[model samples]
Structures are given as structure tokens and as C-alpha cells.
Target: MTDFIKKLEKEFDTQIIRSNKHIWENYYDVDNDGNITTLYLDEIDLRDIDILLPIAHSLVNLAVLDCNIRTLITLKSFTRLEVLSLRQNNLYGSPLEHLSYLKKLKKLDLRGTNLTDTSSLGTLNSLEMLFIGGNDHLDEIKGLEDLKSLYHLDVSNSCINSIENICANENIRILNLKGTNLKKITHLEKFPNLESLNLDGTLVEKIEGLETSKNLKELFISTWRIKRIEGLENLTKLEVLDLYLNEISKIEGLDNLTNLKWLSLNSNKIAKVENLENLTNLELLLLEANEPITYFDTAFFHNLVSECYIYMRDMIDIEEIQAAAPKNVKINYDDDYRWPTSLYRAPREVFE
Candidate 1:
């Protein structure tokens, strides 16, 4: 009960709301324009803000500990707020109940919580990044249809059975649906704009509607079974393709994808190098964990062969790279950005 907080109490007492002792530790300051603003605090704990129902609108930036706060009561008062992260909290009750008031907000991280219903999400249309993943209890997510501005939608491991209804959202460039029991996906026609589609551990055996998705760049399709590269010949915009553990291996139809910079074909059975003779833009090629790659002659791939990366930390030598490269051309190899795990072992060959 400090003199300053006492003065704040007389001006803000909605049903005798009490202030937590944690609020006193915050350092308050005023700007040149006389607008009151709290710059920083050693610790951020907002379990006691209900007392000042009127000042909630003044909290332009509030980031609380994910544990202490369960359900936000007067969050709508944060009309001036922009950035908020409620990660690692219970977040019970109507998940989108209190956040609708933050119209000026930019980002919202509700990852790994018990938020079941996401029906009120469309109201916050200005949001750019929506991290609503790891909520196993969540079964319904219908309100995102109006989020025409959302760039990233990470609904990974959220128990979502069907997102066929949400396919029309064109603004989403990155859509991650990893580790779900989804066996089939229909009508990707709705998302003619999807750049990155990750179906790593699902039962998607075939890629059906991707003939129209020319903008698709990075594609991670592992687990389950995809036997052929039949439908993706027209994917000229493809940059990275990760087909780690599958059966069929003739990648002929993909010759049209000249923009392909990275290719990952590990843990499969492929005898030939296919028709990549025209893929001059290729940079990094991951062909480990498949059949014995000790046979790919480097001279065949020298036209565009930059750096041949095999089994995560190792680079195929110039002689080894020249096995797949052209004899007339010569280039250095550098294993830059890395994938931590690969079905193939690094030391089996060479690592530097």
C-alpha cells in the first residue's frame, strides 16, 4: 500500500480489486509528451491487474509469466497493446475471450496450452504470426477463415482432423501439420499460394492437388508412403524437396523444376540419378541413407553441381563430387546450413 498505488486505487476500484505486491517492483516513467508508460521491470507478473479496470487500455505492452496467469480477465482494456506472449500457460476458458480488445496487436504465441476452442481468432485480423500449436485438447478451429492477413499458421500436433475447410486462406505461406493421424488431404486447390507444405509424419501417401501450386518452394514429405513423383512435374517453383524414407524413386517428372536449389532423397531405393542433367540451379543435394551412393559418377552432375552434402556433416569430395559432376568443370564444396539428423551416417564416408 504505497502512496502512489493508493492514489491509483482511488481512481481505479472496480468492485474493490486488490493489487498484488509484485506490481510495486515495476519501474514507472513518463514520456516527454506526459504520456505515462512503464518502460521495464526485472520481472513481469500480471496476476493482479483487475483492480485498475480503467487503466488496462493503457498497457501498450504486457508480457507476463506463462505460469502465474491462468485466465485473463480485463485483457480487453489493453486497447493500446501490441506485443503479447502467453506461452507455457494453462490459458483455460474461451481461448480468444479477452484478446479481442487488443486490436493494435501484432503477434500472439499460445503454444503448448489447453486452449480447446479457437473460434474467436478471426477478430484479431491484424495478426501476422499465429502459433497455436501443441494443444492436444483442441478439436475445433473454424474462425481463421477471415484471417486473410495471416502469413504463418503452425497447427502442428493440435489434434486437427480436417483442415480441408480452411484451405481457401491464400495469405498463409507456411503451414505445418506434423505428427497427426491425418490419412488424406483433399482440395489443396483452395491454397494456390502455399509455399511450404510440411506433412512429415502423417499418412499422406499421394500428393494429389499440387499441380496448380507453382509457388510451393519447400516441401517436407516423410513417413507413410509416397510411391511416385508423377503429379509434381509442373512444380517449377520447387526449391527444396525432402522425401527421406519412401519407396518409389524415379524423379523424372521433376526436371522442369529448374529453381530447385536443395534436394533430399535419403532412405529410399534409387539405382539411377534420374534426369537432373538440366537442373543447373541446384546447390545442396542430400542423397544419403538411400541405396549405396558409391556409384554416382561426379562428371555427370558438374554442369550445376555446387556442393554435394551426404549424411549431415560430410561433403562429397571434388573427385567424389566430380563423380556426379562434369569433367570440364571444377568447383569447391562447402557444407553450410545443416540438418541435424539424416538416415545416413557421416563418418561412413568422410567429414571435415
Candidate 2:
């Protein structure tokens, strides 16, 4: 072992292995008595440290790597790293230049980093999960089309204006594009394996692009400019649907989703719960902060099963509605508080 690596081992209280012939090919601490599982180094400014090449080469078998180092210049040696997190760093240059070499990386989190270009990430074919949110300068995600193994991708709160490059990766299951400038999603039919999609806080005025997404289970289009619920009749396998904070005045075109469990239409202009009679599998329904439901129908409660709970505005009489509801169903009325109360009267045997 060299004198520099020997000093670092004693300083960090960890073992460092060094090769005499191949000095660059060395490993970190091995499992002695089950003391080390991963190498976690966060909030450390690596710019002041000089011998970073030896320290980077030592993390060969590292499974979980978390480093907030100011400069990511020496991360090329961590080839065996599986999970890497470099969030909240001061990386201004091309920090992702060496990450493409980590072939075993599965989860990567670069949230709040200064990355503007992501062209090097296309080489990481084994990456399954990636989070690049809060990057204000990232206006385009152009090089992620080859990530066929990716399943979950969160690019929320970024400046992504177009997603034309992301339509080719059909294996993605969960895609979150909240708080972007996406006005239209043109390629919904390409992702047949997509299960969950979030387009909240975008400029989407219509719901028109989902024609072949029959396997989708969860969808969130809240805070959009949609006034009607159209183009969702093909998603028969949907379970959770969130259309909150929109201009939807009616709840229509959801009768096909019989497997739906949770439906949120709160903070809309809906005046009644009319078309939800077929959602017998629905467990939770949120309709609070909307127009007052003037007509209370007992048939709505009769269609829902005993485990179903409906949350509505506080203007309705809870006791009167509970008397008319089915024996198994529960109705919770909001208390008009700033934080809405969950006060409801259910049979004591239901909780027991």
C-alpha cells in the first residue's frame, strides 16, 4: 500500500486495499464482521482534498454510494456502484461525464444539482430509476430515448418544455412531469407498458393523447386547464385518478373504470355526484372544496360497498346523510376549516 492511502485509511477509520502491480485496481473495505455495508460520504467538500483518485478507486464493491462532493471528477472508478445519489451539490460543470461508466447503477438521484445537459446518461442502459427534479436550467431531455430498462423517471419542477425525445423508451412504468411547460403530450400510444403518469401543474388544456395506454393504473392531471373529462374511456384498468383544481363542472366518462379505488375531484365546479354510481370498487372519493351538492341521493351510497368512504363539503348535514346511507358505507363531511376536518360518524363495529 502507498503512504498516501495508508494515511487516508487511518484518518477515515476504514480499511483500504491497494495493488502493488496494478496500483489503480484496488478495492475498499471488505466485510470483516458485518460492519460495513456501503460507503456513505455526504456533505463533504472534495475540492480541498488532494488525493481523490486513490479514494475513488477504493470504492469498487460499493453497492450504495451517496456523496455530496463539490466536484464529481473522480467517480469514474466506482464501476460496481448500484445506487448513487449526488443531490444538493454545487456541480456546475459536466458532472455526469463519468456516471455512464457505472454499468451496475440502478437508482440515480441528481435532484437540485446544477446539471443542464444530460447527454451522457443515455449510455447507462441498466438504470431503472432516475430523479432529475429541480434543475431549472434543464429545458430539454434529449438523450434518454435509449434507456429501455428505466421504469421510474421523475423530471418534475424542471424547465422541460418538450418531451419529444422520451417517447421511444416504451418500458417506463412511472413517469412524473409535474411543473413543466408541456402543453401537449403527443406520444401516449408509444408507451404501452406505462402504469402511472403525472402531468400536474402543466399547460395541458385537453386530455387527448391516451388511446393505447390500457395498462395504466394511476393518472394525475391536476391543476390543468381541462374543463371536461374526455379521452379516458380507453383506460379501463385505471385505479387512481386525480383531477383536482380544474374547471371540471361534471363527473362523466368514468363508468368503464370499474377497478378504480381512489378518485379525487376536489376544488372543482362539480355540483353533484351523479356518474360515480358504477365505481363499486372505489375505496376513497374526495369531492370537498367544490360547489355545494344540493341533491343528496341515497342511491349513490347504495352502489358503493361497505369499505368505501366519501369525502364531501361541510354544507350537507352529516347526520341526515348518514341516516340515508347504506348500513356499511361511511360519509365524511368537511368542517370548512382551513385544513379540512375528517369528522365522520361510522358504526363502532366497523372499526372493531
Each candidate: RMSD: 9.1, 8.9
Which 10 residues in a row give candidate 1 its minimum summed lDDT?
343-352
lDDT tens string, model 1, 1-352? 2344445535533122232221433333434554433322222344444653544545554444343456676676777766565655667763566788778776676867677777777788777767777888865567777877777777767777665744325777877777665677666667778888777777788866677677888887776498876577768888888778777566566768788877777666765565777677777666544554433444336567465443322233436554544543433333564443332221110000
Candidate 2 lDDT, 13-49, residue by residue in tens: 6555532221222233433443232343344333422
Per-model CA lDDT versus the true structure: 0.61, 0.69
TM-score of each: 0.72, 0.79
Error (Å) of candidate 2 at residue 63 is 12
